[model samples]
Target: MIKNMKWLLLVSLTFVACNNDDSDTPAEVPVVAGSAVFTKYIALGDSFAAGYSDGALFAKGQSNSYANILSQQFAAAGGGAFTTPLMLDNIGGFSSGGLQVPKFPTRLTFIGATSSPANVPGVSATPITTHLTGTFSNLGVPGAKSFHLIAPGYGNLAGVFATPATANPYFARFASSATTSVLADAVAQTPTFFSLFIGGNDVLGYATNGGVPTSQDPVLGDDITPTATFNFAYNTLVTTLTANGAKGVVANLPYITTLPHFTTVPYNPLTAKSIGKNNDAVGLATIKLLNAQLYGPLKQALTALGAGDRINLLSETSTSPLLIKDETLPNLGAQLAAIFAPTLGAQTAGAYGAIFGQARQAKTTDLILLTTKDAIGTAPTAANSGLGIAPAFPLNAFGISFPLQDKHVLIPTEIAEIKTATDAYNVIIAAAAEAKGLAFVDTRSVLAQLSNGGFRFGNFTMTSSYAVGGAFSLDGVHPSARGYGLIANIFIDAINAKYGSTLRHVDLALYPIQYPLTIQ
Candidate 1:
């Protein structure tokens, strides 16, 4: 009986070993061959699709592009090869006649130990001779507007070099012919799958220009692509792209105002204590004296008009409002001139007119662009030096004697116009996506979440905050490689849900949060 029990125990041990082997090597999850065919994938859009980062486009940036990332995953699932009009070097600027003349500045890099950043030039310039051959897969043009994709001669090299309005230089480099349109080139490929995210530039130009309307006429160009125009163009693109039974995903525009370009600098950055050694009574006394001498009469005039609070006295220990151009302050230059004419004389008063002519306090709704931070306290140009009351004062420096221009600050009215256009465009995008049965990515919601707290992907977290955000690149508008990886995952999720494709998501940690000056 003991021998029988020993044999039974050995049989039990053998059964357990077999079970462990099955658990250790579970059947490989069968790669679900999704409904959509990704044999020939193509991408279409503006700078974001083109992998524009650090204020310029280069080879590394293009390699890590979200479209490229998606294509890699597609390849794993039996997709074909993907190609881009790759720039020659990591140094973003291109060379002309063997001499580098960068149209835009280089990428941003953290200077020393401080959070402050500086624009660093690329390591090498791409020669003009470096051009791609044959039809390419990634057809993203850096600055193409919605209407521009269909506009013929947009890639004409002659027009690009002569008149920017007539053609786009970035497109000119790779265009099949001078008369080829972006949409036509994209369609000629006969793609099995495509990704498009356009229309950002349509409203972005207006917002960046401080809501300065380009033109009321839609055909005039540089203006916000009218809602009707966007709808027509977008629908046509979808119709043409899907005419051959190709599947695609489309992303809507985010609120441009929320970008770090507008959010980095606060509206009220100036405080009496922060400006200089003003924490002491002596410093306070000097500031008061200066205010009384220069801004006293003007303060009284604003008080009479029921805008006394708008007059920012330099004596206050708390934060002071930013100086801005208020068009509603009727005849402001003349009013300020009249106030100073008696003491400073007509010639000096005339100079004051040029100084305080459009000056007003920036409101809570005002957005100070990131680019304006550097110009805040610098001296004015030589021509405008005489505008100061004395050598002790200079009117050219921002906040000192010069008020912020309309271009530097987006006022409340301008903010309203941007919001209106954004909302209208989003509605059109959603409707088109639904009608076409295409995947839609709500980029606005994603950006909003990033701004509110942060976004989490795998083991990493990213925010929309300037340099530290680990999402946006040095430009503060475009995303870093890691950020693009996050975007690729988002697109993958949407694509999977719509097309029934089980595309694998990318690991954000693989891509760097901050791209180095040298391409790795």
Candidate 2:
């Protein structure tokens, strides 16, 4: 089934590429009025449409946004003025309680063959009070989901501090009213053309949070948006936007797990050499001694069950498989505590059980998030030194004693759930585009290309690799300026085919592959 699915996707992508090819050039081509209207273009979606990069929404990133690039091309083909809710400065941030609060770090800079964080302070000079007013064309909110477009009070400033989930700071800075809906605000402009690239955040939140739901309610907060709810909301959005006879383009969701944020780190990062030992025997022996003390008689049982192989003996190694939460493991802790109760006393045995009970070695299928890189070899704080599991031996102090928290790793089961949700959402988006007769952009195929081989645009090549990929910025999830420029050309191909317009594609080489850490 998987092989067949891959073949079908490949064929679909080939069809799209062939359609986009303008090889049979028209000499002295006559101007043609396309079937669709392009007098006013309004883009509506999340961070990608907003041109958010390096983990922040700043002026330079917004200027190079895909929507802005598309609008510029549209102008030559009879489109009108395009505007965005621009940030005050290149150093992106927001304000809280009338004081500047830096939301994201500055853009990354390449220094001497390495990508490092620029020496910029966290605080931004611009406050959220510096608002840009007027019915703007770009309606892309950075963290918006599919349902958020129809949700009222999503832009309420009062809800910013009181109820963050109910309010969006980006929209609050420019929403027409406290109770205004994102969809309603976009519709009020009566746009002649629009582009919708939502649904990424619907499943992205689950992946980014290491597949843990924020609340008990799976449909709310940082869980996957229910498929039924997504269908209803998506259908309504397309229906309302096209009710006035405006033509547009809609992009499908890509697999968020494939991005560098989740793929950069490998699963089996530990080895004998990494532990500063000459042989695997030395490392294995050291880990066995620690395990015997930590688990007692349960140590043999764990080895028999292959748990010993997963435990990294290396101490303070930068690259190591993160010890993670494994609730599926047998109640070895309880059994061990009972076995050692007579000699060690109940309290001491129980302490040992609490420390090693729920912990296990992360598997190859599991993914340790990029954020875990900093905390991997670091020492645990006083509050987290539970029972001093490795008090005698400091080498086992890092991950063996201090297990990586649930938020740092995506277990195999969580990965399966994310894949399921992403597939279901893509189906809904494709069906909606077909029903509305709107041009559909298969972003999944594009992302697959970026992940596997690498996408070539004009004279440059880009991939989903971290830092040096040239496609993604420091944040890993969002695109760099050059990446957005390539995306603009993809949209142009779909638009020209659907509307029968000869819209010229943008020159991607004009955009910079990497933005300097500071404004130069």
Candidate with maximal lDDT: 1
Regions more than 4 Å wrong, model 2 = 1-33, 97-99, 102-119, 216-220, 271-299, 304-320, 339-345, 382-400
- State the lDDT of candidate 1 residue by residue for 1-520, as single tens digits: 9999999999999889888857677676554438778889999988889998878788888888999999998987778999899887776756677656555445567656756676665444665434455888888888777778787888776775553247776777788888988889989989988999998888777777666666522222446777888888888888889999998899988998999988988888776554544465654564576577656666776666566766667646666677777655655667666766898898778777666666777777889888778767665555433343422463435654467767677888777778888899889889888988889999998999989988886666799998888888877788888888878988998988997878888888888877775556
> Over the full model, what C-alpha lDDT does candidate 1 score relative to the true structure?
0.76
Candidate 1 lDDT for residue 145: 77
RMSD of 1: 4.8
Please list the residue runs of candidate 1 whose C-alpha ends up more than 4 Å from where it truly belongs after superposition: 1-29, 111-115, 122-124, 128-130, 213-222, 272-274, 277-286, 382-394
